[model samples]
Target: MEETRSQVDWLTRAVEALPDEMTFDAMQQLILSMVFLRQVSDVPEGEAQGRPTWEELVGQVAGKPDLVHQPVQRALRAWSGSYGKFRIDLDNEAVLGQMRSDSRVVDRALRDLIALLDRAGRAGAKGDLYDQCLARFSEDRVGGDYYTPRDVVRTMVGLMAPAPGDEVYDPACGSAGLLTEAARYVETHGGRPADRTGPVLRLFGQDINARTRSIAAMNLILHGLEDTLPRDIGTDNSLLHGSDAGEKYSVVLANPPFSMRMPLTDAGFVFWRYGPPPKSKADLAWVQHVLGALKADGRAAILLPNGAAFRGGAERRIRAGLLYDDVVAAVIQLPSGLFSHTRVPACLWVFSKSKRAHAATRVLFINAQDTGVQVSRGRRTLTGADAERIASTFNSWSKHDAADVPGWCRTVALEEVEAADFDLQPARYVAPVAAETAPGEDERRVRELTEELYEHFAEASRLEHELRDVLGT
Candidate 1:
């Protein structure tokens, strides 16, 4: 955690060092791209026979800054395949040409950042280091779109409980954080963390933006222990009106873009597993897309906007089909500000093709809107203990007939669900704590009820007389 904070602080210093035209996104791409090359290459950056590696070349520029253009250009050409579509200002910077005739500013910034990374590396903070960079990089940016706070990712990953040889995927994997955590899950479960040639783990991801995809690839190359598996992060939209790929996985964990509106490019897409979603609001569409992509007996935990829970019309129909199919396993109401991108409430919908442990006729409802500790004005995050508490509740409930905690969680039968129009709002089923009655409270309640009933009877007589006059009786 301190490493991440330090990285964020240094990233701010790096951004302040650059020209106004440079964006945090652009700066991040350049730095991480270099970091990726340094990590993936077998040879450390060095002064090798006439062709020094990029890091060695950067070091050579400290004093004689005017001569950096040629070596840096060579490095870009050498590693172009690895960095693909970075949209970086320099492909690499030519000191004299684009550095406004002063190369030291760029040189000093890169030197300092890389130095910090080297120290962190020896300090054992090398795993997924750029997650910190990306999180901090988005802080001042207009929208904190790709920042899926790490704790949320960790909790979601814990809930999925992926095992060795289990195929894991994320449809809208920003920076591939979910995939990174899933890889960790495999390692923790007595499986290899990474296998370059014959990996026991399979990682798949798709993001609509090519730039983010490239960034994700670079991020994965460095930290995820990805040297073992063939990475399959793609640039195409996974919800492409049809099968994104005929691929399915053992586990599907995703927090897809919510309330997205794109034209239905595949009108005959045949999303009948759940049902086709409206074009204007694609929340259920992504949900259906994920559901359809799951193999029989597969399990998934999806993050969704609260509207997907109880919205009327087409969404209502979708909810009915999910419940009827018995694939809707649990609904967890997350706290507000869990996401820094939008203040809209969030929830988790866990689906299982075959629920062998819990009864299919009933689903778990956990109202955790009060779970997180506020960290900022409009943001909050679940600490390790906080997440464990929430996760333990669901885990115990799923694996055994765990006693329900009043006012927090409840198991609602399908009949009750149907009575509520299949509404998934957690509060609808999980009642709040009822205050205990004081002494003599029962007599007070009876007296209040008798007086109220008599007043209602008198009003009924007056209404009857008014109706008779209106009917000319």
Candidate 2:
């Protein structure tokens, strides 16, 4: 506990010391250097481990037993040379002046420090220490941006319920969060954590960004999956390399980037069979990729933008093909602003390769757009209760009872789906419950007109305020 607390304090200090204009890479280097300084030092006998003096530790590494106050000078010089930068005397005011003039030197030093620490971490020297360093990195860098919250990850994993012997994969594994959650689920279900090896050996991921791949590897290691057998496979530019084809998985979970465009050639010709998706939207292509990667008994849960459900043209054809296969099991509509980066409402498309007794020819539609609570201004999240409600709804659907909760969830037949031009938008089919009737139509019309007039008055007032501000009133 002392070591953990010390490491945390060191990380906090290092991050705090970084320049405000520091690039992400530079911040990474600074954090890595601090981690190394905290972990890779010799301990004196009979000394308490809590809060060892940095000066004493640096002096021991430099072999200058008598130069306690001068340890920073030697440490600076040693780190400079290791990072491929010119050495400087920390105690020399003139040298420090010269060092501050060259920005390239600082960048090089930072890069070297990070590279050295990354190499050491991957070399099996101190796995737990390395993971703590990575946790700090994730906290500082990712925070709540572009990555799912940890609680949401846990909820998704619970709903998926990957068994110890199940093969799990995430095609767009951002930071490998889903993979780690799946591993945790296996352990909590009475399976030995080490059993995450052979069955977990089937873990795979692909990302288009190199830095994200590194983050994924670090995340997996931090989650006690460092020793899992068959090793996790991850690669950057995976789609471009065409490496994920012909591979299948027992379970897949992903939140792919929304509405991004990809060339048909880049996705390979095989996706064309589902009918070519529009060039400007690659949502259907991603759907096809997930479908192709699923084994005969596989299941998938994918997050998609609102456009994927009711879009016309090629996307409609792809939707039709999926329905034809009876692979779609459920569609859960999520609230807008649930993602940190975008305000576009999203949905979860759940698919199963083989139809269970309750899932045959029936699609469970959940209108959860109003389910989550607000986490920040204009941002919302599904609490544990909300997730449980949705999961229970799904569980009920899987048990063959048509869950017919008005305005919340319902089971749609394939015939109705075909009648709607294969549109999968949840709101189109599920009707909301009725409220008590008003006294008369004329009274209701007067009330509606009064509300419209108030809206116009409010808009006029807002415009007047804006004009006054612009005129410096």
Candidate 3:
């Protein structure tokens, strides 16, 4: 999918043919319908488990066009927080309502989409189909947080290094990129990425938005994660209404909203594993959530705003608590413009429930803010080299043979962090660099140096004359 231009694929073209303003909800549901149809087509007839097959729907369409929505409606059984049981409203003229008016055009579009799916097969190998579906959503209908840059996601996944039989989760899984990367990690470690059944691997997610929740679930489906389709993901507020309360996971990766000042009403909520955050920002609240959700040995990588580290009062308490418990593993400051919507830069905070065995005495701090290249006019991203460098630095420190680089990375002892009042900011821990001057600063410096030398010579001559007078020469 060439994202630089509108794709000519049948999915994009068919979606473009939808009627009216083409809302976000409608587009997500429509894509879900297509994905469901594809999944149904792939399963064996006897093993469909009461799901409808795409060929069956096509057969009904061939017989009577008036009953276009009937077959799909019947095939779609309502599940909790899913497309309503008994039927999905596919014929309300909002999305497919124009099907009644321009039946021929709509039929042609649907058939073209089906033909395209058949030619390419139903399930994508890895992130292929999910990426295409996201590309389609990128046209005009996605409403949520900025998508995590692919390289950043890759780097985070590498740092966590999820293993086989690990249970991976992302709480604010806007696009499910973190879990997708986790799935990839499982495959790299001699496991299956598409294995949805238990014991091998498990992927979990929770989102506040209903539409984005649906999109996340469908994204997993397209990525060939069929067993993870109807797992623990739900459309509920992770801060207020939490999920997976007592179930700790093996790996957790997340990019929660930075400034969603969670209301302070939940001082008694069960989600407050590290107590409650301030009434202003939810940054540390998300941190506490991740920390609490981790199994005793689980490791997590979180992308958070810079404020969460050094903010005073309530945030300071959270930081101090984490440091005291020795769960704060490492912090990596990222480059600016990683997210286009906001100007605030972000950093990666890695936490391990049991760090005493590995990085027991010190917390690794990496300053990678200057390593990214400006790929676009305003967006700065980490190149493959940059990612490798950062990830390597983390691994080196984790293994206790870290090579310290000035202005790049530094390891500080836990006692030092406690002395600094638990300031987890990378700038506080990393070494400083000498001030760098601009192009013309050297010329001005040279001139100033010459003038100072002439003045010193004059003063020396005056001193010589005074000495001659004293000697009566």
Instruction: Identify the candidate with maximal lDDT.
Output: 1
Model 1: residues with Cα > 4 Å off, grouped in runs: 1-4, 37-55, 68-70, 82-90, 93-122, 195-199, 224-231, 241-243, 432-473
What TM-score does candidate 2 reach? 0.69
In model 3, the Cα lDDT at residue 42 comes to 62
> Which residue pairs in candidate 3 have backbone atoms (N, alpha carbon, C) closer than 3 angstroms, thus clashing?
78-84, 78-85, 93-97
Rank by lDDT (best first): 1, 3, 2
**TM-scores across all candidates?**
0.81, 0.69, 0.74
RMSD of 2: 10.0
User: lDDT value for candidate 2?
Assistant: 0.63
Write the residue-wise lDDT of candidate 2 on 1-473 in tens digits.
01345445545644554455556665664354444443433234334244333445543534633332234344433433211111211122223233334544444443343334433344333434545555556545524332565545655666677776676777788767777767767877767545524544346667666656655655554444655524444553433433354467888887777887875566434535477678899877777777777788888888888899999998998999899889998888887756655557888888888878777887889888777787545556677788878767876676656648899888998999999999899988776565666679768768866976686699689989999999999
In model 2, the worst 10-residue window by lDDT is: 81-90
Clash-forming residue pairs, model 1: 195-228, 196-228
Where does the lowest 10-residue lDDT sum fall in candidate 3? 78-87
Comparing 2 and 3 by lDDT, which wins? Answer: 3
Query: What tens-digit string does per-residue lDDT give for candidate 1 at 6-107?
Result: 545655665565555555556666666655544443255352334456456547655555454455556655655533323222255533234444566555
